[model samples]
Target: MDYGEPTKLVFSLQDPKPVLCMNGDVKVTVEPNGRRKHWDYEVTGSFVQRACAVRSRAGHVVAQIGVKGMLAGKDFYHVVVQPGYDQAFVVGVIAILDNIHGESTRC
Candidate 1:
């Protein structure tokens, strides 16, 4: 599926009180690389989110965070991130709707 233009979002990191917001719609291009699919995202967000005072080997911030928006019908998806030099943690958020079976479904 083609998402057309990328969506924008924001992320707030506690501790020095840093806020990151994308200037425009991020461009996400997904392609198949070998066995796993690779997602290439190009975004120009504000200051990266960092936790604590740890720094990288190159003397950079230890962590960073960002957010992205997704569409699940009328509901929306928000992605939280904890970016590091080698790895990152991502969290996805979606609206909860009451279904007939009392369960949530994704559009």
Candidate 2:
């Protein structure tokens, strides 16, 4: 993304189970993997940049994430994932959440 960092696409993890996701001032977090394992998308701390760690059950980082802020009312998430992360799986999870919570995209 020209507005942020270069985007990298990862293959699907194929497990789009529900997870708790939060973004506070561009600090994103996702956790609670499918098998009740403690998996978390740990976003790095930065005053300007937004980065995340896609962690595994063993608390090891499996991927990295970044994002570009979207303009108001875009109805889209501008996520940038590094290698070892599954882009499809991430997007699919969001899709599932949106399906269940129809107001997620409402501005």
Scored by lDDT, the top model is 2
Candidate 2 on 3-85: residue-level lDDT in tens?
A: 35345422223233235323321212353233543333432332123344445545555544444565563344455555777
TM-score of 1: 0.17
Q: Candidate 1: which pairs clash?
A: none
Q: Candidate 2: which stretches are off by over 4 Å? A: 1-54, 60-74, 103-107
lDDT for each candidate structure: 0.30, 0.42
- Weakest 10 consecutive residues, lDDT, candidate 1? 89-98
Report the lDDT tens digits of candidate 1 across residue range 1-107. Answer: 98464653232212221235323313223332335333233223322221112233244443334324335533232333336423321221111111321435354
Stretch of 10 with least lDDT, candidate 2: 9-18
C-alpha lDDT of residue 68 in model 1: 46
Top candidate by TM-score:
2
